[model samples]
Target chain A: ETSAKVIDGKAVAKQIKDEIKIEVLKMKDAIGVVPGLAVILVGDRKDSATYVRNKKKACEAVGITSYEICLPEDSTEEDVLKHIADYNENPKVHGILIQLPLPRHMDEARILNAVSIDKDVDGFHPLNIGLLAKRDREPFFVSCTPKGCIELLHRYGITIKGKRAVIIGRSNIVGLPVSLLLQREDATITIVHSRTENPEEIVRQADIIVSAAGKANMVRGSWIKPGAVIIDVGINPIDDPESPRGYRLVGDVCYDEACKVASAITPVPGGVGPMTIAMLLSNTLDSAKRALKFE
Target chain B: ETSAKVIDGKAVAKQIKDEIKIEVLKMKDAIGVVPGLAVILVGDRKDSATYVRNKKKACEAVGITSYEICLPEDSTEEDVLKHIADYNENPKVHGILIQLPLPRHMDEARILNAVSIDKDVDGFHPLNIGLLAKRDREPFFVSCTPKGCIELLHRYGITIKGKRAVIIGRSNIVGLPVSLLLQREDATITIVHSRTENPEEIVRQADIIVSAAGKANMVRGSWIKPGAVIIDVGINPIDDPESPRGYRLVGDVCYDEACKVASAITPVPGGVGPMTIAMLLSNTLDSAKRALKFE
Candidate 1:
C-alpha cells in the first residue's frame, strides 16, 4: 500500500471546472455576457488539432462561447496577424490563444507579441511575465500550467511560505514562472537545470519539488526528501509492450519510488495535464468579468 | 591574517570608465556622433540632486553629452511625461534615467512606463525585465546594480555556471534581477528573503553569495560557506562614535567577519556603489552604438 497521499489533480480539476461552470452562468445572468475564448490554429498538426477540439468542448461544457480560426500551412505571418488583430478588437473574444509550434516559416515571437496584453490568456506576453516576476505586482493571467501547480498546492493546504522549493527545469512556459510564483509565496526557491551539478542533492533539500524536466524517471526516489511534496509536470512516454499502444506515460519522478518517499505527489496523465484547460477557462471567465466590470 | 582577496570595485569601475572613454572617443571619430544621456529629476531632494550632479560629472569624464531637466517638487506627472516624450523623440538622447522615489502624488509606475523602452537605460521597463527573465532573450539594458554585480563576478573570474548561488533580498532592482542573471549563466540560484526560515543554513550551502538585504552586518561569518565568493550590495549607515559624520556605511555581510571566511569579498563603500554608475555609462554607450549601427 502506498503510504503517501495522492494529490488527485483529476478530481480537483473537475471541482474547479464545476465551480467555473456555475460562475459562468452567474456572470451570464448578471451581465448578459458570455465568456469567449478564441483559438488560432495554423497548419494541420494532429496533436494541435486534438488540443483545439478538446478546448472547444470544454468551453461548450462551461457554457462559454468558443471561436476557432484554422489557417493553412502556407498561410503567411500576415494572415495570422490579421486574425489576431480582429480577435483583439472583438469584444466577445475575452481570451486569445495561439496554438504552439506554428508553421516553420512563421516568426513565433512576433506572432505571439501581436496579441493584446489584455487578451493574452496564455500569459505569454512579456509584460505579463514581467509583472508576475516583480514583487507586489500581479499578472493579468499566469500561464495555465504554473497556475494549476500553485492551485494544487493551495487546495492541499500545503504551506509554501518559508518552505524550501526546488524547481527542475527552467522553461519559460512552466519552470521560470512557477519559480517566480513560489518565490512570491515566500518560498525560498532554487531552480536546478540541465547544467546544474549534483541535481539530486539540490532536489533532496526541497520541502516542495516541482519537476518539469520532461525526462521520464529523471527524479528518483533517492532525490526526494522524506515527507516533501512533489508536483510532477513531466509527461514523458516510454515503450511498454504490455500496453495496447505499446507505450506508457510516466512522470519525471518514478511513481512507485516517489510514493514510498514523498508525503504528497501528483500523478501523470491525470495531474497537471487536465488542470491546464481548466485554468484557461478560468482566465477566460475572469477576463470577461473584467471586461464587463463584474465582481 | 586575512587570506581572502579583496574584489576591488573602485579600481575596476575606474578601469571600465577609462575603457568607455576610449570607446566614446572612437565612436565620435568614426561616426561623428557623441553618446547622450538625459536625466530627469523631479523635486529638490538633496540626495537626488547630488546623484544627478555626480552623473553629470561622470558623463563629462566619459565624453557623453548629458542633458538635465530639474522640475519643481509641485510639478505634475504631465510635466515629467512631456519631458520623457521629448527625450524619446530626441535622437541625441541615447539613454534616459529618472531619479527614483518620485513625489507621493505622482504615479511612479505610470511615469516609469512612459519612458520609451529603447532609451530606458535604467531598465525598469517591464518588457525589458520580462525579456531578461525568458530563456535566450536578452534585455536592452539590465538594471545597473544587478548588471554591476554580475560584472564584478565576471571580472574576478568566479565561475558561475553549475555553481550554487544564494541571493539575500528580493528587491526588484537588485536581488531578483541578479538571481535571473546568475541563472542565465547556468548557476543554480536560491533567494533568501525576510520570510526564509533558516536563511543562514541555506546561505552556508552557496558557492557564491550576493547580499542586498540592506541590513548592516546581518550576515555573520558563520552564515557564509568557507571559500565562497561574496558580493555585498548593501550600503547601510550605522552610527559610529569615532566618525566625524556620526555614522558609517556597512554592508549586509559583516566585512571583518566575512573576509576571513570568504575566498573573495567586496567591500561596502568601494564595491557595488561605484559599479552602478559605471554600468549606466556602459549601457548608454551600448545604446548609442546600437542606434548608430556601430559594431
Candidate 2:
C-alpha cells in the first residue's frame, strides 16, 4: 500500500493567520492605526451571506476592523457605487471588497472596476491582473485562492522552478491566475481546459498538477504521474445519503486513488477552502501597511 | 525530398494592408473622416527612426493621416507626458504610439501608462493586456507582433482548437500574449522558457510551436513532430562572410531542417517581420472606425 502525505491546508492557514495577527498587533502598537476592510454585499444569497459573515469574523479575530453594508436585493447599481466611492476616500478603509455575484442585472465588470486599484484587496482589477500577467511587474494583490495555493507550496518547501505544472481549468479567480503564479515561480505551465484532448496524457507528464475543474472525482489515479504533487481546488459535492448534510464534499481528484499514486495531495474540505479567508486577511493587512507607510 | 508549405508573411501582410486600405476608404466615404495615428519618438536611435519613417509611409499609402513627434535624448519625462496629453486630447488622432527604448533617464512604465487607454494603439498598456488575458473581454488593440502571428495562422487556415501548442519564450510582447491568444483559440498551451528543464522534450510534443526566444536556429528538425506547424518570430543575426552586411538574419527554428520536418512554417525577414506594421495600420483603422461609429 502506497501512503501519500496529505497536505494540511487548514493547519497551514492557521499558522499564516497567527503570523498576520502578530503583524497586525505590531502595526497597531506602532502607529495607533488598525487595518480596516469594508465589504459591500448587495444581495442576501445564503452562500454569499455566509461567506461575508465568515470574512467579518476572520477580520475581527485578526484585529482588523470590519465594516459591512448589506443592501436589499432590489438595490440599484448607483447605491453600490456610492458606497464604494465613500470607502475609496475613507482613511480608515485600506481595503474594499464587493462580495461577488452581485445582482445579475447590475454590470459586474463596472462594479468591480469601480473599486480603487490601491484598495482592491481582492486583486480583481484588470490593471492588477495585467501587471500579474506581465513580466518584471508586480500586482497590488493576488486573488485569495490562487495566492493560498502558492502559499501551500511555499510552506511545504516544494520547489516550483523548472517543474512541469499542469492546471486543469481556466477560471479567472483560480486556474488562470494560479497558472500565471506558477509561471512566475519559474515552473513550465500547461493549462488544460474543457477543450483539451488527451488530458490524461498531459496530466501524466506533469511534475505538479493543480485541478480546479470543479468536477467531482474527474482525475483518476491512472492520470497521475508517480510522485507528482497534486493541488485540488475543486470543492465539489456528491450525494451521500448517509451523511448528515445529505451530500459530502469531494475534490476534482479521486482522493483514494490519487493518494496511492501521488506523493502528496490536498484533501477536499480542509484544503483550499480555509486558505481563501486567510489570504484576504493577509491582503488587507498588506494594504493597510502600504497606506499607513508601516514597515 | 520533403516539401512543406511556406507561410509567406510578406504576401499575407500585403493582403492585410490592402484590406485595411479598402476599409479606410469606405469609412472615409461614409463619415468624411480619415483615420489618424500619432507617433512619439524619443532619442536618435537609427533603428527607431527607420521604423517611424516606414510607419508614416504605410499610413500615407492607406489614406490615413500620420502625426510625428521627435524628441531629443535628454527630454524630461514631463516633456514627453505633455506631448502625450496633447495627443490624447487631439480629436483627429484616434491612435497614439510611443516608440520603445526611451532614454535611460525616463520612467518607461510611467510614460506608457500616461497614454489614454482608448488611443493606446500599441496595445502595450496594462489595461489592454489585462483585458486580453481575461476570457470574454476584448482589448482595444492587441500588440502588433502577437496579433500578426495569430493573423498568419488564420490566413493559413490552421486549426488551433484542440492542438497541443508550445511557445518558446515569455517576453511580454510576443511569447506571453501569443500563448494567451492560442489558448483563447482553444489550443492547449505550454510555455517553455529559459528555466524549463528538457525544453526539447517538451517542444517535441507540440502540434504547434511559436518560437520568440531570439536564439538563432535553436529548434531543429529532430525537435519537431512531423506535420506540426511552426511560427518563428526570432530575428537573430549571425556572421556571414558572403553577405555584404557581414551577417544574415535567422529565425529561432533552423529553416533548412524545419521546412522538411514541419507541414508549414514561417521564415524570417519575409515572415512575422512585415506583419507588425500591417497589424499596426489595422489597429489604427479600427480605432478610427470605433471613434466614428461607422458600421
- lDDT (CA) per prediction: 0.95, 0.94
Which candidate has the top score in DockQ?
2
lDDT of 1 at A240: 100
> Chain A TM-score for model 1, please?
0.99
What are the per-residue Cα lDDT tens digits for candidate 2 across B1-295? Answer: 7867999999999999999999989988888999999999999999999999999999999999999999999999999999999999998999999998899999998999999999999888888888888886888989999999999999999999999999999988899999999999999999999999999999999999999999999999999999999999999999999999999999999999998989999999899999999999999988988888878
What is the lDDT for B170 in model 1?
94
Candidate 2, residues A14-126: lDDT per residue as tens digits? 99999999999999899999999999999889999999999999999999999999999899999999999999999999999999899988998899999999999999888
lDDT of 2 at B96: 96
After superposition, candidate 1 runs with Cα above 4 Å error: none
Q: Which stretches of candidate 2 lie over 4 Å from their true place?
A: none
Interface RMSD of each: 0.6, 0.6
Cα lDDT over the full model 2: 0.94
